[model samples]
Target chain A: MPERVARRTWPVHAVLVVGALVMVAPLVWEFLTSVKSFGESVRVPPTILPGTWDWSNYTKVFHSIPFGEQLLNTVLMTAGRTAGQLLLCSMAAYAFARLAFPGRDVIFMLFLSVLMVPSQLFLIPQYQIMQELGWLNSLQALIVPGVFSAFGTFLLRQFFLSLPKDLEEAAGLDGANPLRIYWHIMLPLARPGLVALGILTVLWSWNDLMWPLVVNNDPEQMTLSAGLATLKGEHFTDYPVLMAGSLLATLPVIVVFIVMQRRVLEGIAFTGSKG
Target chain B: MSNRWWKVLAAATVVVSAAACGGGGSGSDGGPVTLTYAIWDKDQQPAMEKIAQEYTKAHPNVTVKVQLTANKEYWTKLQTAVTGGSAPDVFWMNGPRIGLYAAQGVLQPLDEQISAAGADTAAYPKSLVDLYTFEGKKYGLPKDYDTIGLWYNKTLFDAAGVKHPDATWTWDDLKAAAAKLTDPAKGQYGIAAPADSQANYYNTIFQAGGTVISDDGKKSGFGDPATIEGLKFWVDLIKAGSSPTVQQMSDTEPTQLFSSGKVAMYYGGSWEANGFAKNADLTGKVDVAPLPKGKKQAVVIHGLANVAYAKSKNPEEAADFAVFASGKQAQRIQAEAGAVISAYQGTQDTWVKAHPQFNLQAFIDQVPNSVPLPRSKNTSAWTKHAEDLLLKAWTGEKDVADAAKELAKAVDEELGKEK
Candidate 1:
């Protein structure tokens, strides 16, 4: 029986290899183009490999914009937003799932309704609020509005509902209050949901383009994505320099993903089946 | 508990509305001022910064901050900021948007400022000055100008044994040369005929003695017989197998194909000279000439202008900077940078001398017979609709005459609703 199963596995392995190549082709192309001259990059019947590996494009990216300052802004903004969402979303999800409040059902329904509207509808109104608070072109404007999100709350709520009620009931019978029960019993078991939310929030905050571009005007107060966008021109764009800047910007995110690959896959798969 | 939730929501709404009404005005006219200058070109940032420095040298109490945004998102960002009443002090404006912004009351008229400074408005081209004037008020001062020309690959022309395009070349002469230059075995076509307005069809329509819109900006000229003849010039080339198919041109940019040596002739603007000069593959292999004439000789001329905001905190300084930026001294500085042709009367010779490899004078020679870019109060509303309808005729899905008539009626309806 083992030999028969092994004989049929070759074709499946071949198909998987092809799918993997399709996913990795664009990254490989971007790296290749980053090292090429501008003329060779746009040549018809494009060359697969660079004839000359030029490194000046990387240095040009730094001279054109303040890459170091923008990278630091991006990191701080992502960390603040990710940490805020994890703590706030877990508490709100715990309340909606376990507590019996006066308007629990209606309030939860209202939270779900926010997920249906497009995010662009809130841009002007949010800008006005930031202006009123004198927070325009500041890091708080990028972080404060993004801290509260409906999707994160909804995802955490589903995970909380799947937890057994007996554990919380036993804690309640032990003379523990509702806050203590939530802190000691419920959160520890919802580890996968928290990890999943943290990963999604980090990815979204790192690559958010339109908001940063609109709210901030100073180069010192921008993110990596918005700073890299300034490399594009009105009539002509230097593709090699643009690709080089983007590749440099993407390295840290790729490294973080690689370090958390196992837990990320498990956390995502676990939520997929449970929800 | 439900009553308490309602009370909290009501209190939040009241706080938000009150805060919105409180933050309207900013800064007062006093000791020192820093005006924000917004532009969209990355390549020209250094020249812009130098100009800002020059302005600061003349006026010690004011400092100008140069802000750069890519062209793709500049309009969207400007509109949102303007709606929130936090727009920049002075910014770059174009011909297509002057009417819209002026009509919306966001742009400040520079007529009073220009005369007070003793600057000569006649130093710039009449066409560009006329382009920025809307409803008898000047909203922008012309900064630079560009015209379209016929750029062809000299290597292909030398190999095909055909004469290069010159001023005497007529429409028949262009057709004959195109037929001789096409080589199927080399996977090469003679020209590219994309449905582009500025570079391809707009020049031909004017050359064929037709207008895009009436001078009064009240009607569409697409229904005229001469305009249909202009449209047929490109459709005929595609049908004759001398140009690439519409599908092929859409897959890859026509400009890219021309630079790659797959097409012999391309209709491009004066801006193309800067890019082609930098391209290594196109070095010493391309040159430009005046566009071929049909019933008349004409080309579409357009440029960018500097405009001041109406509600700025320091309106006097902003208007002063706008006028100073368009003067001959600043225009000379821009021309010496070799990026654009300055609109000042005597400053164009430096731009022409900047690129010696190509015949850059062809762009300057046709300025006398140039037409200002066709614009209305809201040009974008109908421009997109016209491009979509013209594609059907270019792709051979419908007759050119029928498409033109349908497009004319639709554009007229859009113009009627503009006011």
Candidate 2:
């Protein structure tokens, strides 16, 4: 019986291993390329291993732009957006899921409608709003627009709807106000939902490229993604330096994901299983 | 719930009102003036700042801020800023979009300023100056120019026992050299014949005595037999096993392939000299000659120009800065920095001297016989269609004649829309 089970699982393990390798290849290539000299990076039948692990590419990335400031901006932008989305989206989702009012369904539908339109359609209008606020080249311009996302509210709303209502009713009998119940009861129950939304928002905000580039021009005001973009020239690009910057920019996010891997997976699975 | 909604509305209203009132901080007065100059190249940003500082030094009250966006997204950002009515006071403009921007009335005309300053427009190449003019109004001052040349690998030529390319080499000499240099065992190709219009086909089209766009810019010239022959020049090389297949060139760009020593020859632009000079591997191995003669001796000339915004608050200062940035002294600064080949006449000597290893004069020598890069009121509208259709011919999936005719028809339709 053990032999049969092992035989049955070997193919699954093989497939899983192949899938993991496919996903990891580009990242491995990026690291290898980042450490290679410019000449070796572009050589045909590209060398699998570098002749010399040149670390100047990292120094070049710093010299080309204000790397430390941009990294700080990216962290601030990510943290602000994540925190804002969690609080606002949870509150709105709770109200939509539990409270009844005039045009409640209509407003909920209106919120969901925003998800249908492409994000690019908002670029020009958002730029105009930022210009009016004199927020161009500012951190608020990157954070504020991203704080309120429709997808986040919708996902949390489903989680709220899936929760049992008996606990809320018992709290009501104890004279707990709606906001009080949300804070003391629903908020703790919705921990997994909030974690999921926070993770997604963090990923999106960290990698957001276009809006930041369009609104901000000052090097010190820029984020890592936008700052790294300046390294790319029209006709020629130094791939080694670009790869080095990208690897540096993405390393933090990778570390964060690894640290929160179990929580992220559990949160996603909880949402999927329930709703 | 209702209270929450009201609170959100109140907060939004406060934010909007605050923004509206605070947006007027940059109002023009008899105070220190700041002019924002937008550009796309990070490598050239330092030289641009130096130029800006020169202008600022002359006018103590004025300060210039240099803004950079990468080339890939520069247009999108500029368009968004333009729509928001907050574009940079002065910015770089290129050939393809010059007509589109000028026609839309976004570009401030520089003719009056040029005449008022008695600036000799003759100081820059006439073709480049003509390029930035729309409806007989000059919208920008010529900044720099590039012409195509035959860049070859010296080590490959010596190894293959072939003479190096020079002024007298013609189409036959190039073909013979390409065949001699190619060695299949080493996975080496003689030349990179990618369907790059600026570097590869445009020069050949003109050399074959065929125009891409007519003198009046009303039609496509792909239907002409001479143009087809010009295209066949590269296709024959690929078919003869002397050049990389289109698929291979696409995987690794022709420029990169040549730089990596996989290809022996590349028809690259003068702008490539800086990059080639910087690459450690290609050092002492690469040099350039004037493009091999086809039906006639010709190359394609193209450049960028600096233009002022039409809605600039300080229009006079903006125009003055634009002209000053394109002056001979500023061009000299750009040349000495090795940023680009300055468009100003006689300043190119500095650029040529900046890189003495390669024969950059090969680029300058073709200036008199150069044809302006083909552009119309909306060049990209047709160029996009041309690229897609020409890929069929490049891959040998379709015959060159059939592809060109299809391309000509598509380009004509796009050009027709410009009317």
Question: Estimated TM-score per prediction?
Answer: 0.94, 0.94
Each candidate's DockQ: 0.30, 0.40
Tens digit per residue, CA lDDT, model 2, B42-126: 7788889999999989887778889888999999999999999888899999999999999998999999999987889988889
Those runs of model 1 whose alpha carbons end farther than 4 Å from true positions after fitting are A270-275, B1-30
Lowest-lDDT window of 10 residues in candidate 2 chain A?
A266-275
lDDT (tens digit, per residue) of candidate 2 on A1-275: 59999999999999999999999999999999999988788777789998999999999998888999999889878877777788889999999999999999999999999999999999999999988877887777877898898988999999999999999999999999999899889988998888888778888888889988998878888899998898888766788999999999999988997998998788667656312
Best by DockQ: 2
Compose the digit string of candidate 1's lDDT tens values, residues B1-419.
33553464464344334322222233445567788889998877888888999999988778888888899989988988888877788899998898889998898999999999898889989989999988889899998898999999999999999999998888898888888989989978899989999888889999999878888788999999999888889988988999999999988888888899999999999988888888899998999999999999989999999999998888898998999889888898888877788998999999998899999999999999898888888999989878999999999998988998999998898889888
Task: For candidate 2, give the docking quality class from DockQ.
Answer: acceptable
Deviation from truth (RMSD, Å), model 2: 3.6
RMSD to the true structure for each prediction, in A, is 5.2, 3.6
